[model samples]
Target chain A: MLLKAEKITKQFLRESRNTNQFCAVQETDFTLEAGSFAILTGRSGSGKSTFLHMLSGLMTPTSGRVLIQEKEIYSLSDKDLSAFRNQHIGVIPQGQSALYSLNVLENICLPYTLYHKNAHQEEALALMEQLEIAHLQAAYPSELSGGELRRMAIARAFLRKPELILADEPTSDLDDENTKIVFAFLQKAAREGAAVLAVTHETDVSQFADKVFCMKAGVLTEQNSL
Target chain B: MKLANSLPVRNLKGKPVRTAVLLLLTTLLTLTVFGGTLMIISLKTGLHSLESRLGADIMVVPYEATTKSNLETIVLQGATGYFYMDNEKYQKIASCEGIGQISAQFFLASASSGCCSLSVQIIGFDPDTDFTITPWIKKSYAQNLQKFDIVVGNDLNAFVGDTLTFYGVDCHVAAKLDKTGTSFDTAVFTNSETIKALIQSSVDKNMNEFKNINPDAVVSCVLINVAEGYTVEEVLNDINIHVKKVKAIQTKDMISGVSDSLSGIADIISLLIAVVWIAGIIILLLAFTMSVNERKKEFAVLRMLGASQRKLAAMVMQEALLVCLLGSLLGIGLGLLILLPFNQLIEELLNLPFLLPSAGQMLTDTIAAVLVSVLSGGIAVSASAFRISRMDTALILRGEN
Candidate 1:
């Protein structure tokens, strides 16, 4: 197993006294194997993205532990956890995630440079070329279209070639053709032996996913395995 | 090429207007700090130079001359006019009970002689009885003044070995005095013999007032140093009572008016600097806050890409430092351009003695100003850097609270 979530749960305090607690993600035991493409489908506010955030080490669970390659991620210090995430996990966030000051190519290369590591330019360019954003290499994010920006975000996640890829609504604003390209790229990442976990509302994502899960009202359940 | 270049530099380049405004504020802060501080220092230095140049407790002048001329113009402003008391008056003042050192000085104006472009005051000191100008002139020239040998002041156009004509007589310039930012800087110094010759030549030329003067038997003014335990007022009163037709003036009384005006100007400059500093820091705080706040999402994105909170804060600080460094250097440059070239004009406008610190002191001051300006930027934006760095990445990424 590349990732194992053993009885993980997240709770938020209710601002109003009418409610005792708000559960963003309920108790859920989930495991993802190496070389597997998984999709968790849910509508907005369904907590699928919240679950993915926990798996990516972006949030701490109220209880329970998350282990990647048998190493508990949350057990590390904040600095260590951030460094581990940088070297091991790649996340494609929803909405406008690009750094406005940087161009498309610089944005894609940020994951490596953020750690003060050498960014491999030939690999980044190859990825941009594959995503069809090669011509927009020097274009700032503001100049990019919704679909083009989505592809650029996807390209940035793949720049490091991490062992775990977590993408949230990566295809939300992408059109059908661009959506196919992004999913194909995710499937290719999985085929090359990386565990890929993506959250989306598109049911068609199941066609490219090896394992499909559904989250409704903070409750996660495995639907089936491809 | 690695596409990840310095992000802060690019950020500043991206937002030109915000950067320019911040730059301008930092520039103004540094300008006021450096220029105002320098001006205050120069004024104080000039005052000290004036006091040293005066180097006397009381001056005895003819009462008729005192009626026509203010003590400040004759002593501080280097105004030239000849007024004489007999050698008998000098002898009486020298024998006063509290007198420590006494010197008799002669004054002759070269303005009417038409040997120089501007009105130059010619001061003739009795080398034997003089303790005032001779000791200062010794710093430049070791040899005593021969017949017409002269030591010019720092501002004079003549150099050592140059011929300076006084009353159509060629006076040899033996040496030059260092700049003191006093009237001495514009005056020429020589022995009594040279000036007596010049005075006689003026009378021979049939000059209006010079024709009536007797340079041999008269002394222009008697400069007196009071004893250590005695007061200038005591000695001045003694001279006034004993000497007939002579008024005694204290050097301190001559410069008190200038001191009061200098204190007022110094206070105003200090207040201006305080206001500018407060305003500069506030402006910088606002600029950084807005710039950082607007990029919350962007910073969140960087965090998600595994940028540590420290790295995020460093980026913001780097941008601030760059702006501050550039702004301060430009401000210092602009200040030098204004203060250095127009120093004389500034002195004239303020009507105060003005002397700049040495080049080495100025260089140190410039470095200190730049460091302070840049450090201020860091201090002002520190809170913002901390706020953004410690922001909840998940909440920001989700675009929610």
Candidate 2:
């Protein structure tokens, strides 16, 4: 298994009530094999995003554990966990995730530069060309359209070519054509031996998934592939 | 570590207005701290130099001179005025009990000294009996002054071997003295013979106040040094009681007025510095806070990109450090620009002595001021860096917090 979650759960304390707690995600066990594409679908407030945040090691699970390549990720220190994620996993966040100050090309190189390493400019430009944002390399995020910005975010996540890819609403702002383009890219990443998990509301996303899951009211359930 | 060429600099460049405001605030803070401190130190140094240049225990001036002119204005300031008592008083003061050394000084003003726009005070001291001027003059001139040989003060336009015509009598400048930031800096010093000849020339020229004055058998003031066992007050009292027309004033008494004025000015400057620091810190704190609050989502995105909490905090601090470094150097440069060129004007405006310290001491002070400026900037932004580093990344990324 490239990624595994064993009975993971998340809870939030209601700010107005000191003694009360609300569970955002509940008792979820999941696993993904190498070179597999998984699609998670749920409505708003269904905790789909919350579950992905836990699996990606951005939030510590209230119970249970997440293991990536059989190493318990949350068991490591915060600094080590951050490094682990940078080297092994890529997360594409929801809306407006690009740093406004950096141009599109520089934004794509942020993962390398964050560790003070030299960026691979040739690889970054090749990825931008593949995503059709090569012409907008010098443009800042504010000058980009919703669809173009989403494509840039996708290209940035693939820059490091991580073993695991977690994306939230990857095609939320795209039209039908751009949506199909981004889904094909995610499927390609999985075929190249990466475990890719994408969360979306679009039912058509199931056509590209090797496995599918549904989240509703903080509870997760698996569904047969389309 | 390579922060100068990092995202911090690019971020600052992206938002030009915020960066400019921060730089301007830091600049003002350093300017006030460095410039204000330099002025206060210069005033204190000037006072010390004035006291050292006087180098006398007591001055016995004509009683009429004290009543007619401010003693500080005449001694510490190079205001042109003359008063004389009969030479009998000098002889009497010499024989007084516990007298260390007594020197008679002659005073004359040139109508048009050809050196300055205004008349300059020419002071003539008896070389054999002088205790005040001889030691300092020896540093520049080894030989005793001849009849026409003159040593000009630091502020004078004449140098060594230069001819200074005072009241139509050509005098040779033997040497120039170092600056003392006192009236001595503007006065010319020579032996009694040369001053007498110059006075006689002035009388022959029929200059105002030079007529009807006999240069013979007269001395303007007597500089006295108390013996080791004698107190200055005791000697001053003796001179005042036994003497008829002379008033003996202690050197400390002559400096008290200027010292009191300087104290008031120092207090005002200190208060202004405190206020500037408080205001600068508050402004910077608010600036950092507002800037961080507006970019909460950006910080969250960075966190999502696998930047640790410490890295985020370091980025904020790096931006502040770069801004402070540039702003403080510019401020020190501005302070030097303002203080060095207008030092004479500042001295005149304040009516107090102003002397800057040596170059090495000043450079050390500049470094200290720059460090303080940068440190204060760090302090001002510390709260923001901490808060943003600890913010909830998931909540911010979800756009809920």
Candidate 3:
């Protein structure tokens, strides 16, 4: 196993309108083998995105040890941990995830460029080529269509060859062609030895991952094995 | 660092419309500030040098000129139009107790032609014993000076020949005075007899011009020299009480009064302009704060990416510094462009034979302008940076764009 997120719990502090604190995630134990792909499925406000945030080192779980090769990312200093997350984990947000400041090539290369990693322009082009939009390399994120943007976002995640990829709603609202392209890339990344976690409600993307986890309220439970 | 480095100056690449608006306002603010500073400095330096070269303790001109505003127009410019004393009164002044050597200068006017309107000041003095004018007089035609011979101030001699008609009488330019860097730079000088004769004839000529029955007017303003131990005020009071019709003013008093009067209206205008400039700086602060606020999401994302609050603040500060640096630099360059043309225009009109930065005031004004721009920009960032650092990362990550 390359990562273990065991006994994860998260509580969100509610404002004075309710004057109450509520747990968003509670005691969720999870394990992922190297090169495994999983889909986290949940309804709105069901804590699926919260769990993915903890797994990606973007947010800390109230209680848990999320270990990537036995290094607890949440426990590291702010700078050290962000560096670790940028180096080893890739985060892909929902639709319109691409930063407009970067062009198609720069958007795809952002992961490596922002972290000061050695740049490989050819690799970013190759990834975009696989998504069938190699010709759109110079296009801005705003100029691209929904499908082109989603493909570009996936390329950014895969650019650095991160050990773990966490994407939120990887193919939500995307057309069927884009949906297939996104799923195909996620599966390929897993097969190539990266742990991939996609949080989604879409049934089409859910079926593509090797394993699945379901969340209700603030708790996670095993739904299937690969 | 890498983000800013990786992108073209964001103004060039960022939302093009917003960048254009920002650049326009920044450029206007900078130009106004830079040009305003140069004008102020130039005026001050011009006046300061004027005060420094006046070789007198007290200048006893007519009270009408001194009592009026300091910028009162006078033709007391060169040695050619010098003032002669009331003869017995002159002897009385030389005899006064606590009095030092009295250097009496007699005026003789010379026109380019006997008919030309252009006139120059020709003053006559005793070759020895004159303290005020002799220190810088160089030499006074050392070999000999007769009634028709003259020694001219530097630039004045350069124009007229060795023999120019003074009071319609021909006079020789015997030798010359060193450059005085003063209004007197265009005056001619000679012995008392030459000047007295010239005045007698000029009176005769003006009497002929006006067809006056007697001399039109006898000389301009008389200058009094005081001993080293005596202050100008002491001599002024002594002359006021002892001498009749003539008033005495200390050199230092003339300068302060002149500066006050010369810049009085300008000071009022400068104050109003200064307020406008201050408003400009405040606008820059508001612009910078708004600019930073617009990028709040971008900065929050950087913070989420593990950039510390300090680093994020530095990034914002860097943007402001660039704005101020560019704005001020452009303002200064623009100011120089404006000043170059304007200065030439002023120098031509005034001929400023001895111009100094209008009076001791140029430097302070320029410094105030640059400070307003940079200090405001720096303060604006500091005010907003603290609030930014406290922003919650999770909220930003989930917040609506």
Per-model TM values vs. the true structure: 0.93, 0.96, 0.80
Q: Give fnat (model 2).
A: 0.51
| Candidate 2 per-residue lDDT over residues B1-401, each given as its tens digit | 36555889988887889999999989999999999989998899899988887889999998976663476787877887777788888999888887898999998877776677888888999998998898888988888999999998888887898888987889999999987777788889999999888877877888736356777777889999999999998999999899888899898888888888999999999999899988998899999999999999998888888888899999999898888888899889999999999888888899888888778878987998899889988998999999988998888888889
Positional deviation of residue B49's Cα in model 1 after best superposition, in angstroms: 1.5
DockQ values per model: 0.60, 0.67, 0.36
lDDT per residue (tens digit) for residues A1-226 in model 1: 8999999998887777646888989999999988999999977888887899899998899999999989999998877888888888999998878877788988999988777677788899999999999999999999999999988898998888899999998888678898899999999999999999999888876999999999998999889987
* Residue pairs in clash, model 1: none
The alpha-carbon deviation from the true structure for residue A113 of candidate 1, after best TM-score superposition, in angstroms, is 2.0
Compare candidates 1 and 3 on DockQ and give the better one: 1
Q: Give the range where candidate 1 chain B is weakest over 10 consecutive residues by summed lDDT.
A: B110-119
Q: Model 2: per-residue lDDT, tens digit, A1-226? A: 9999999999999999968999999898999888999999989989999999998888888999999999999998878988888888889888879888889998998888888888888999999998899999999999999888988888888888899999998888689999998999999999999999999988887989999999998898989964
Error of 3 at B334 (Å): 1.3
Best by TM-score: 2
Which portions of model 1 show Cα errors greater than 4 Å?
A: A13-21, B1-5, B67-69, B112-116, B208-211
Candidate 1 residue-wise lDDT at B87? 80
Tens-digit lDDT track for model 3 on B1-401?
Answer: 35455433552355666555555655666666655555444555545545644556666654442443332233223322333434655555556555665655554456554423467766666665555555555454446567787666655535334567766788876677654445555666677667667667766766223233222233334456677788667777888788776666666666664466447634754776677567766776677678767766666555544455665666567666666666666666676676665664553354332232422333454455557666666776677777676666555555633
* Deviation of model 2 at B320, angstroms: 0.6
What's the lDDT for candidate 3? 0.66
**Sorted by lDDT, highest first, which candidate order results?**
2, 1, 3
lDDT of 1 at B373: 94
